[model samples]
Target: MGGKQQHDIRHSDRTPAALGYSMPPEWAPHEATWLAWPHLASDWPGKLDTIRWVYTEIVRKLVPGERIHLMVRNAAEEARARQYLHRAGCPLSRVLFFHHPTNRSWTRDSGPIFVTRSQRPHPRAIVQFHFNGWAKYPNWRRDRQVPEAAARHLGMPLFEAFWNGRPFVLEGGAVDVNGSGSLLTTEECLLHPEIQVRNPGFSRRDYEAALQAHLGVRNVLWLKSGIVGDDTHGHVDDLARFVNRNTIVMVRESNPRDPNYRRLEENWELVPDLRLEDGSRPQVIALPMPAPITFDGYRLPASYANFYIGNAAVLVPTFNDPKDRLALGILGELFPDRPVVGIHAVDLVLGLGTLHCLTQQQPA
Candidate 1:
């Protein structure tokens, strides 16, 4: 592999897209899945114990499909995670633990965005973009180190993403790729100035250019906003996702009185007119939103759209709502080859995210 040689080259001079690398679709075959073990009590507060159990359940479901590479703070944390995994009956042979400390367990935002180039000397590499605690939260210094540590551990070349000669901030959950030159994102997350000022003075056109240069995408479909309770401003993973190159699974709220109803409806309307890279419109599938889940009067982000697609199964976030079964059935039809397993996410969402928010896939 040209991993060492590519590491010597300065990625600051060129973008990953110019180097013939692009982010793959989630449904693609993965070598492993990366996760950070939940350790911070402040993230879950009163629900930490239940949240730990949910994390173990998530590990149990994913281990059967692909290797799970977990990040722990230290040897003690690793031992604790091992005990939990063992009790959960996860296949120990398929799991590996790394001593990488993180402030929070949400790996989707802090983790490296893995890219691939079929003809390159080193087929696999990673894009390390700046992360600023979603531009709202603090205590992210340790979380920011995750990408470089992960790249070193995996022996993959790491490329730093920049805009106007400065590092740019972008989370993996903020954008979804179709692996066919089309990208899906929201204007609320990337373009919202006051909410999450990711890159100062970056406009919509500037973002599109940066995405094309870094992600190798020809078309970008921007939704207006996300659901009501999404604290990351508006992560597209909680609102919409690309199931295939020509299809999208988006969230839709049925009850008109709900706060998310209007925004989701507006986003749903835009999908039919959205064109793909090939100039053909994509097949839009509307996924149901679960009933509002609240703790201390705050609505948690509990959309089924946060499901993670793995090699052996599609891990869905299921709230104990009537719509959970409906969402599973719809996704089951979409991913006929993979088993649709619902991991109860009522406790997981207490941290404001679910399956897709906690895991990052490494393409094979």
Candidate 2:
């Protein structure tokens, strides 16, 4: 085993160690959220400036209690990122920049899977898996090592998984775990034979088993697909999100005429039918989709579900649509303790992702 197993967490009948790699709950704790500054000009087209401001605004909100590790290709870009963060009024102390070159800025997919285990009698923190650009984006050499490299920088054990290491594909954005043994993912992203390109002989069982072994996910609720206009090919983060163990917030499309209408409605139908590892159905909340918006002849995939839960505030991506206030109000209700601030994502969506798409939470 690439990881040393420990048995301790008594959630109900099963221990975390017995589940799989035994990563801790999402709400367990976090030192900070990790993000890689988007430098690939190809990703943002002509809107790089607008997107930088979006990220800077995001850092400003998360800097209250949680730290932010920002990755830049080199010193030149680091200075540029620093200038943007400074101009955006982000707290300098909470944001730390590293020299890691990546093909893209979606760290939530390329970055590490931070897991925690308290049963070791000592501080045990682990990061599993790496990046291969989802078998779609070519030239992922740099993105591949981010997880372990960041882990070494953080001084934690890099528990790289064995057995399942060879040809399995899973992105952090595609799977949302409540950190309580239940996981939510989209078959459109993971099960697509064209995207993940399942090994010839391996069946769905192999994929599920791999998820269980590596991510400590016991109950995987698979929704059929994801939202349209999503370039990553139907990542779950864009459709459904785990607000907590028992509560889930999903994106719903009311317009049956839209392309995403049926897919989202299908997810709505599937949500109520699933059970967690503890054998309990979750309380589901339906968040209506903001009226669809487009920019420069492109339909930017926008979702209220892409909000990032930060230490001080819940950072929401706003499309500047009329529904912005309503989305914020809803989130404010869910997270009563923290202020839900919307960062205008009209520009960020041009890059094909929002707040949570750009950051990965590093467990404390």
Candidate 3:
């Protein structure tokens, strides 16, 4: 592994017409699931121990099925994480931690976007992009520089973009691809000019062009909003997710009084009965949203859409509400090969997020 500052992963020698970089499916062989060790007690408040247990349980479910690539900031956190994994009886060999520093444990949104080629074997590279704390959380300078460290540690090449010689803003949560060209995202989060500070030269077109070049995305489907109380404004992950090339499971609200009922209904109508580049409308399914979990009168973002699909099992966030079982049943049907396990996210959401918000999966 070698250290290089802001290494560009894209080779300028090839044109988009000449280059053949298609986004591989999520189920493609994963080297390991990437994660950041939790440290900030401020995010968990008094129940940090319970949060660790839940996170440890997540590793327990995933490590048996596949490898776990974790990120630890310091020696103490690393030791603790190692202890938790050991006690959980996870395969020690499969759990490897890199000393990459991060501001928080949400590696999925902040970590490197690792994409691979389907034709090639064991080819893993990282995509380095700019993260501005969703333009909400202002203290994430260290978090923004994660890709450089990840590239050096893994000895992989980096792909940095320069469309219009201007920077682009995108989060891992804001976009989900079906391994084909079509992608699912929210216009509220990605295109909100007032919500984000963009480079003077880059427009929405510039951003889409960059996506085409970097992630191999083609047809971009724009959704309206995510579940309310989400801090990232409205990341698509909390509203919709692509489980396979031709199937997507979305979160829906049934009660009229619920704040998300109308927004969720509109999103349902917006979901296309259309096809992919392969010409097949994705099988659309619905997973009901759990009862709004609140702390001190303020509602926390609670949705079944925040499930993290791992190699072996899908770790879904449960609110201990009635909808928990229904959500798991739906997810289980979507991922028949993998077991659907639920984690009580009632306490977790007090931090303004759930499972999907906490963990990021690294594709093999």
Candidate 4:
């Protein structure tokens, strides 16, 4: 850990990668999971109350495996959350509450991205990326403070990522890593020039350099785009994810007329050509997309690829569709170490995200 000014890596060579730190795969053991308690009614519209219970269920499932670092706005909010968790039979002692206010509850996009070093005294550190509500929403000022607060709370060294003297903007959901130096992302999220542009004027090379410096990535696999109605533009977690170092689970839409059919197919075709960090081709498995879910004239991003891998369980979002069982069975085979649990996410997706989007894992 360094002094406040020294932590900013804009003018220094002490990047996380330079110090041997890399973002761990989600399947790795976690000390705890960070979650921002849902309080904003605008995000879930008419389902805010229902969404809190969803949080309780998630906590109940995860607490047996890892601690829950839950952020709440104030004492009242914490008390309300406690009541819900208590009734749900979630162990209260396993949860640690922080009075950290946030505009939204999606921690994957706004929270600190923790990286780890293998053989160091202080192995864990926080790589604080500049978050701007995914560069799509205006009410992200509070969300931006989450990383710094997290770093202080955990007593971990904080490294501020910057490119060309400006803070670099990135979201956790924008990239998925294999913990073996390979990363998966979509061009629509990082390269699209005019649509929800993050770090304007940054090219592929610039992004690659920044990613290598911060996350220790040696290879980047770029997908064409994401499914329809994803507000984050093209988050990769909604389309593809690394189940293991050598396997990637990607979503494929069978319905030819579906809006995501072509986009997913184009990405699926590229998978065979992609290589892992060690120059070996990764095993690609196809995951089915749930039928289009429409609410208030909006088609929510409801792909099964947005599942979260927890230490106790692999939580997959289920939309009460016929494909839910098939998706769970596929994931169950891939993750034999942990139980594959399907989380009811119809109301959760009304906020435009589900399991993986709402949670961020803290590597142990």
Candidate 5:
């Protein structure tokens, strides 16, 4: 029956896994990085101007190694972004703008997930998972159009993620892959039936099957929870990330009295026990958490684990805390070949995310 079932599933031959395609890790070579220009005033409220400057700086740093495919609301917004990029001395030749309108600036969640296969008439394709504004916010109708827009722009074939003949809702930030066959995610994010309820009736086995069928992952490592202030409930990108195929960098809090201490500690405890598909344990590194960042009595999710790995550099978010330098130094040692650049994210976190939450890489 197992053999027959496998043959029956392979008869369709439409899934990424069926075609030998897989989502590569961030450290892999990339064709470009995708970002949505910050336009909606409601997202950052009074800090839109400052956030625009932040976006410009991020573009300046990224243009040296690879192209940046930026999205704008319209022609006017594109012209404004062009002016800012010119002033920031960005390499205009390396940046391309798309007129795709987005409800928010977080392209990491709404952007296309590019997958690649070795042999091909088509080596590049996109997995368009349904986005529902993290299951909390509204005004996401425009945001939902981003993945299809990106696929059309690249002229790549689109594969929609579905289960039981229903569209499956998933945010890219909820999971991290090692480019091999292992995936890292949080139970609090994907398995909680009531809270953020991505797929209401999906169980742990259901999620594992879906991941294996679409992302080509063989092992699913689950962390118990995330930090205290993450609005998405528990995104693995904010708690832990794979720095390399065999190494993981997880956030650790030393102060027991802090609100995030217990939860982060529990997640860290699961690290040593995790093994890859080869039955080998990965080397776990402890990255220090910055002092809590707050704005208007609200705790912002300021985390060092939210760093984005680009083709030529790793952009680490710094919160003006004392541990910022410490985290940079540690990452520098870990990634000797790539430069570790820190971006001041104190203001950026006011939107409840940092570097990794804003950009998505396109594999070269």
Candidate 6:
């Protein structure tokens, strides 16, 4: 299935894959992590102040490992962020601020998707996949300009993704990579026909083609769905993530009565049958789900799988639940090289996401 041609195409043959460029895994060495300052009060309701502290903690944890490229609306907002970071004892030297304005602060969905060229004088480039508020919100025009802004600021080449001559819509949270050719995604996010559909008529093959062309993905392992209360309509980040090239941590719920139990169970069952790009089965480990977090009568998408991997540490979101320790232990064992720290996210999830949802990694 294809849509009507909506834009002019140039450089159609210089796809990232054809040029030997690939999107690296999060665990790969990063030049910096990209974050947008929390400015939208409506996303966190009355919890925006708390969310700013959450951002501070995230910055504090990651700045030790790599530089933080923070985006702010203007000079005033940058000053506000500086004050917060300064109070948190974060080293301002490792934090760089950008004056790019954003409608919302979920950088993982709207920020630049960086790809690397192994055999180049120019080692890095960005693939600008059109992001339209996950196809569920209205004020995303500013967010959509993020990739171009990043490319312009870094003086790197930017490649616009297109499928059937139309701009391809993708959110970085919808897929996870292994730094190899394998990719993890869910049908519920990219292939759904009606509900928050990203591409209007794209099929599995179409997605595979688009991903290969843009991100150098060869093996597309598809999970059936994501957990309950995911407003992004089944982003892969909340259900499963690659802790290493050969291993995946898929979230599981022990309670059968929970709304997320069946959905996560289906994904766990499907993982064993999937293969990586090299035709080897991935080692699947079950990560425990946090107890359902509800605020104002709504279930929040809070899972340990939404952890962010930094160069210095793995920052996992904790919900003040007992299983928080267990989740940290499991991740700690897997990430022996660095400490696996937990960031309190009870108030942060008022915006319906946690750690991984707010940050994007830029490959070194």
Q: Which stretches of model 4 miss by more than 4 angstroms?
A: 1-12
Worst 10 residues of 1 by lDDT: 1-10
Query: TM-score for all predictions?
Result: 0.97, 0.90, 0.92, 0.97, 0.96, 0.96
Compose the digit string of candidate 1's lDDT tens values, residues 1-364.
Answer: 2555646743548788887888899999999999998999988888887887888888887878789999999999989888988988888899899898898989999997899998857688888887889998888989898888888888787888888877878999999999999999999999987887899899888899999888889899999998888989999999999998899999999899999999888997787689999999999999999999999999999999999999988999999999999999999999999899999988888899899999999999
User: Candidate 5, residues 1-364: lDDT per residue as tens digits?
Assistant: 2444333432344788888888899999998999999987776769999999999989988888899999998899999999999999998899999898888988888888888889875687778788999998887889988887777677776778887777778898999999998899999999987998988899899899888878888999999998888999999999899988988899999999999999988887787789986889988899999998887888889999999999889999999889999999989998998999999999899999989999999999
Candidate 3 per-residue C-alpha lDDT over 1-364 given as tens digits, one digit per residue, 9 for 90 to 100: 3343323234453323124565565665566777787777887789888888787888888887778878888788889988887888877788887887788877778888776664533256677677778777876888888876777777866666446665566788888888878888876777766765434445677667777887887877778888888888888889998998878888889999999999888888876754566766778899898887777787788888888887778899988888899999988888888888998888878778887777766676
Lowest lDDT 10-residue stretch of candidate 4 = 1-10
Query: Taking the tens digit of each residue's C-alpha lDDT, what string does model 2 give over 1-364?
Result: 1223211221123322443445554445678888998787778889887788878888888888699999999999999999998987887888888888888898888887776655543254444454667666777878878876775676555555443435345678888888888888877776676565424344567767867766777788888988888888888888888877888888888788988898888887876688988999898888778888787677779998898887778888888788888888887888887788989987788888888889888777
Could you tell which candidate, 5 or 6, scores higher by lDDT? 6
Q: Ranking under TM-score, best-scoring first?
A: 4, 1, 6, 5, 3, 2
* Candidate that would win on lDDT: 4
Candidate 4, after superposition: displacement of residue 235 in Å?
0.3
Clashing pairs in 1: none
Name model 6 segments beyond 4 Å from true: 1-12
When 3 and 5 are scored with TM-score, the better candidate is: 5
Off by over 4 Å in 1: 1-7, 10-12
* Ten residues in sequence with the least summed lDDT for candidate 2: 3-12
Off by over 4 Å in 3: 1-18, 118-122, 197-203, 272-275
Cα error, residue 40 of model 6, in Å, equals 0.3
Of 3 and 4, the candidate ranking higher by lDDT: 4
lDDT of 5: 0.88
lDDT of 3: 0.76
